[model samples]
Each structure stands twice: as structure tokens, then as C-alpha cells.
Target: MKLSKGLLADLRLQPELQVPDAALLALPEKVLQFGTGVLLRGLPDFFIDKANKQGLFNGRVVVIKSTSKGDTGGFEKQDNLYTQCIRGIDGGRKVSEDIINASISRVLTATTQWEEVLSCATSKDMQLVISNTTEVGIAYVEESIHNNPPASYPGKLLAFLYRRYQHFNGSEESGMVIVPAELIVDNGTLLKATILQLAAYNQLPTDFITWLEQHNYFCNSLVDSIIPGAANIDTGYEDELLIMTEVYRLWAIETDSPRVKEVLSFAGADAGVVLAPDINVFRELKLRLLNGAHTLSCGLAHLAGIDTVKAAMANDSMAAYIEGVMLHEIVTAITDKHIRHDAAVRFAVAVLDRFRNPYIEHKWVSICANYTSKLKARVVPALLQYQQHTDHVPALMALGFAAHLLFMKSPAADDPFAAYYADLWTQHPAETVAEKSLSDSNVWGTNLNTAVPGLTKTVTNMLLALQREGVNAYLERVAAEIIIS
Candidate 1:
């Protein structure tokens, strides 16, 4: 039988499978969700569902599908019900649990149901607005909100807020707590600015703008989860929206208002939902540790014949490089007044454990996608910081940096510098390629060659060595030397 509200009535329960209480199905739609992607379903929707099941936050998500990609047929067919398979390693133990999520009250496609979508703003119960419309979605487009639907995400949101203001007489309590789960830093802050800009462009009322500024809470947030879709486990029922996620999950919300916290009461249900005045600590830790480590190590690990993150963890040399670079360099470099050494170490250990999840076959090549951008954003800051504190080259960073340079030799078609590097490598020697690539200000925001003294030379030497000795031999040799020191 296919999973649906009707199927939930007679479905047999397993010890590991959690089926929501029938009462949860009757909850009010309290959240206005912008995207129907698995990330939102996997993280925010997951938390809300879990909370509702616990009788904590009695709410449901009203999803607005704005993308031109897929239709709402699957959701309608399934009664907006889906399954969540939370799996992988945690604290060095296996985790396998299934949840038939009943968080979504309804799914409305914005194109056809713009009126209905706007109608959600009239719901007095709606207090939270959650969105994950990719990074590009939260952009400014000078389009009219008066159209059947607004042209941009911000426009649509402004229209919704305006409708709410009209319905509630611009009550201070009626404004939503907007939490954007886009990967970009300061997503909430930026989205709010864009919306305010659109409001001006549309010549919106000063009173409405006043209400927007005073009542609404746009919270900067960070969400981390390895939620690959659909585990395809036999549950005696089929679910089209099944999502498989790892044991680790975090949704760090930056908010100051107690009212916002009260509205986001679902946060209490999971340790993963952290509410704070500022989330930069979480942001820095995640970006510099988990993502940065991935960016730094992927090329080297892939070139060393390692296909997956778990495989690299199982390998002695690669494992050493991964842990060493993170603990000795990244953790040290990122340590500040807010970020202490012990805390960074703990986070690193957790990250390493996450990387060692035997069930998660995280592909190195997948991490290597958009290689140039990843290096520029993730590694460059850490590289500079590592040198700033120590004043000498971090051998592991240099090795990883070298591996990145080596990895970039066969330029990706999408890489802007692909042609530049293609011709550079074609025309020059390995040493020159290293210096030129590292020196290119466009590649990294700063000239890595001079900004961090001796970086260009060290990276160049390591790159040449990696080329001469092959990835495994060079990695093994350099990683051992770094470890010994």
C-alpha cells in the first residue's frame, strides 16, 4: 500500500518506525514554508514534525511551491505525508529509525494557486516563515507583487506580509519570525533587506514598512545535515517523498526576541534546533571545519584513489591528514574569544566521527564540484588565519593547498579560470603554474603568494612533489612528516 493519511490508519508499527499520532493530523498550519525541496522537509519540517509528535509545538507547514521544476502531484497523491529515514553513525554507533512525517498540512503551487498562497497570510495561527529556496532564490527582482504572483521570492514574501498586515490591522504581534535556511551567510538579514528594497520600489505605504521593520524578525540561521533523499527501505508501504538523513543535524537560529523564541517552540523538541542571539559561532565552526575540511581534502583524497569520505577515513595517511589539518591548523586558526580551543577540538572530533560514518558514501568527486569557488571561499580564509597566528606555513594546509592546485590542472568547464589555468599549465612549468595560480587575485580574493609569506613557495614545492611522487606516496610522506612534528 502507498503511504497516505488513509494508509496511516491501518499501518502496522515497528519498534524503529515512529508513526505520528492521529491528533497531529488535525493541527493548525502555523508555518509558511517557501520551498518544497528535501532540505526543508529534511531539516525544518523534520523538527516541526518531531515537535508535533511530542505534543510540544502543535503546528504544521503550508508549503508554497514556486519552482518550475516539478508539480505538486506527488504530494497530493500522498496526502502531503512522507517518510523520514534517519540513519548513519552517531557517537560511534549505528542509527536506523524511520518516521512517517505528517508535518505538511498542504502543498500549494504558487503559479496556479497564488490567491490561496496569499490566503495563508490571513491565518492568525501562522507565526513562523521558513524557507530554503536555494541561494539564488533570495534575490532582489524589481517586479510587481500585484501580478498573479510576485516575480521574485522577496516580492511574494512582501505580498504575503502586506496581506497579513491588512488582515491584522498591522498588529505588532502578527509579524512572522522569518528563518531562511539558504546556504548563504546572513540569508535572513539579506532577504529582509531585499524585501524592504522591493517594498520601496513598489511604493508601499510607510505605515506598512514601519510595521515590517518593527514587528518582523528576520533570523540569520545555519542548517547542517547530510540528507540524501529516499532510502527505499521496505515499510510495507510506498512513499514518494521519503528522505534519508544522517544522525547529525543542526539548525542554528539567530534571534533576539523572546516572542520569536516562543513562536519557534518547536526548537525545544530537538537538540539540533539551537536558538541564539547570534549564530556566527555556529557559522564559523561549520564553514571553517566541516565544509572547509571537505574543500581542502577532497581533491587530495580523490587523487589518492579514494572515492568516498568514509574510504579516506579508513585509510591511515588520508585519515591523518584529515584529522591533523582540522585539529592542528583549522581549529587553532579559527579559535577566538567566542570560539575556544577545547570547543573547537570537540567539534572537530564530532566532525571526524561524522566523516567516518560507514553508511554514508559521501563522494569526493561530488565535493569537488565547483572546485575553484569552494577553494576561494572555504580554504582561503583558513589559510590566511593559519599563517597569521603561526607566522609559518602549516605543512598540512600547504599539502592540501598543493593538492587543490594539482587537482585544478585539468580545469573544470565551469571554472572561470579554467582557460587561464589550461593555457598556464600548457605554457609554463609546474612551479610557474603554482606561483601564477596562487598569485592570481581573482582565484583567491587576495594574492596568496605575498599576503601569506612563503605560502606560494611552499604550495608550489608540495604541488611539484605530489606530481613527481604521485598522490599516495607524496600524501603519505608529507602527512607522516606533519604528524611527527
Candidate 2:
């Protein structure tokens, strides 16, 4: 059978997918999730769905899409229904499909339902507010309260909190615990600060500020999952592609918010999510192991002419490049005990296995976008830490950085790196094409153009070779120079 809309409906109605209508739609209204993106569906929705099935949180999740560009017709068709496929990696084999279990209760485009969304924020039973609106979503805007429609994430949040403060008549119990999985350092604190900034800018009441500070709980969280939102099997069910992520999903909430732990019952030998004393440890591990390796591998994989991450992993040389970059370069730079040495190695090995999961078509583009932003998250920390501690740049991290620059300069068809670096090159456009285009210190942040030992020279030589030879030849040279050396 076809996994069409009708077929999916039948499947959801089946005993496994269907909890009693009462249980599924209990209207606890506790989960006010922002962003209808796949990560939220795959990560939080999966957990909430489990909690519902096991007679835990009776609340139905109400979703709000902060952006208007997401699916409208598809969400309208099924009353906001979709499927999440979980594919696990064990040894070298890919597991079977686990789909259709986690589906949305209601999808509200906040543009149309701003009032409804705000009302939920003030609802008596509402307790947990979750968001995944990308890193750029968080900001402070002055007109948050004055504007009929809020302009930014923090703006909308502040307005909601203000309303909730009024609705509760300053009751402390009505306050919520906000968890935003934006992969930002100090996400919760930054969000709170932005909200406060908005509050002050808008001249909101002191009572509201006091309520926000006193009652509300904003806990930082680190969420890691390879949720590549590209559906396979061409069902043509909706324009919104189904998402497949590794079964190794993890949620690390800060040591505080013990209530979140109790409410979710998230504890076990392999419970997947952990409540950590310092969420930063888990965050660093994710950045260095999962995200850093991914950033280091993307252009390399594309340069070697590979499509998906799995295919890249299948190619021995590409796989070796990934492993070597992690083991030699990136891992050497990590400072945290939880994320350094053996721990980093174990995580890197797991990430490799995740990369090779055949069931999940982890698209290069999924890991490819926000290259600059991702570098900040993953590589820059290690660079700063290692430089600060050792007082010398590590070789592997430098090599990975050089490799990123080299691929960016390559002018090859089917070159993913070309498009990635197009903007930077277009702005700079290597003067004379003979002298290595990116000699500009701006791109490298420092005079890394000349400062980092023989990096500029090495990268320039590789770029020249690529122009003359090809990606394969360039890879051979890099593999010999960086990987072998």
C-alpha cells in the first residue's frame, strides 16, 4: 500500500497510533510548541507522543508556525497531520522504518491565529513552552507590545507572558517552563534577556517584569538529532517532505528544571535524554562530535562527488577523511573532560555510524546550510579553547579549516562547495586568479591568510591543483598532505 493521505489516516486510526480520542485530545494545552519544523516534530513531538500513549501528559500539543512560508495546503488537508520516521544504527546495519507514531494535534499559522496562540500562552493548564525557530529567530524588538502582530520571537514571547501575567491575576502556578532547542549557547538566558529587553523597550508594567523574573522558568537545553527532513519512497502525500532522523536522539536539559525531568520521566540506562548539571558539556559534545564532524565532512564529501552522507561514508577515502578530521584535528582541540579525548572519540564513532544509516537519507544540504553559523557553533569553540590552552593551533582543526577554504575556491560542476562559497567569492573574486582568491583576512577572521603557519600556502596549492586537475586529484593531494601527514 501506498502511504497516501487516506492510507495514513487509516494507519493513525489503528490501535497503535490511536490513543482514545480523550487521551489524544485531552486539551491539557500544556505544550505550546513554536515552529512546525521537522526537528520539533521529530524530537519533542516524538517524546510527547510517547508520554501520551503511556498515560503521562494528557495535554495535546498545539503547534504554531512562526514563519508563514511553511506548508499550508498539506497541513490544512489533514488538520495538521504528518509522519516522523525514526531509523536507528546498530553495528553497521540500518534498522527498519518506525513511522506514523508522532503526528501533530493542531497546526496554527501564528499569522492568522496570533490571538489563539497568545491565549494558549495564558491558558491555566499550560506549563511547557517549546520552540525550534532556527537560531536567527530569537531577537529583541521594541514594538512587540505596541504592534498588533508581534515582530520577533522574543517580542511575541514577551507579549504572551504579559497576557499570561494578566490572565492569571499574578498567580505563580500559572507560570511556564520554556525550553527552546535553537542550538544556541545560553539559549534560555539569551531568550529571557531578549524578552526583558523587549519588555523595557515597550514600557511594559513592572508587575509583568517581576512576574517574568519570579515565576517563569527558562531552562537551557541542548537537543541533538540527525533529523534530515527529506522523505523517501515518493508518496506524494504532501509537499512537506517527511523527516528521517537517527534513533540516537538526545535532549540535555540544564541541571535545574527537575520538574521537566519528573513530568517527562526521562531517565534510564538508554533513556536517550539526560538532565545534565551543566548543559554546556552535552552542548560541547554535540558541537564537537556530531556537528563539527558534519561541518568538516560536508565540503569534503561533496568535493569527492558524493551525494548523501551514507554514500560518502561508503566511499573508503571519504569515510577516512571524516574519521581522520575528527580523530586527528577536531578531537585534539576539545578541552572539556566530557567532550575530550576518549569521550569525543566515542561520540565521533557514533556520529559516523549515524552518517552511514541507510534508512536515513541524511542529505548533504541538511548538514550543509548555515556553514558559517555552524562553524561558529562547532569549530570556533574548539579553536578558541585549544588556542587558549595549548597556545598553538592544533594541526587537524587547522587542516579541516583549510579544507573548508579549499573546497570553497574550487570551480567544479556538481560542486556543492562552489554554491556555498559563491557569495564570499563573488564579493571578493580572487584578484588575478593566480594568487589564491581568499587572501583577504576578513574571511579567515584573523590574518589566518598568512598567520597560520603554512595553511594559506597549503590551501592555495590545493585550490590551484583543483583548477588544473579536478576534485579527485585535489582530494588525493589533501588526503596525502593532511590525512597521511
Give the winner by lDDT.
1
What ranges in model 1 sit over 4 Å off? 411-414, 482-485
lDDT of 2 by residue, 1-485 (tens): 53434555456555534323333544466678888777888887777766666666656678877766755566666555455666768566766554553336677776777888787766677787889887338776567474555867787777778888888887878777888888778888889888888888888788888888888888788888878776674433443536676777887777555565655442332366677668776766777877888886776676667888889888767777777777766677774555657877777777778887876666675565655456655776676666566666565555455456555554442444456466555655343231343354444354443444554455555555555677666566566765557
Candidate-wise lDDT, in order: 0.88, 0.67
Candidate 2 yields a Cα-based lDDT of: 0.67
Per-residue alpha-carbon lDDT of model 1 for 286-372, expressed as tens digits?
Answer: 899999999889989988999999999999999999999999999989997999999899888889988998767799989988877
Sliding window of 10 residues with minimal summed lDDT for model 1 = 8-17
Root-mean-square deviation of candidate 2: 5.2
Question: What is the lDDT, from 0 to 100, of the residue 250 in candidate 1?
Answer: 96
Which candidate has the top score in TM-score? 1
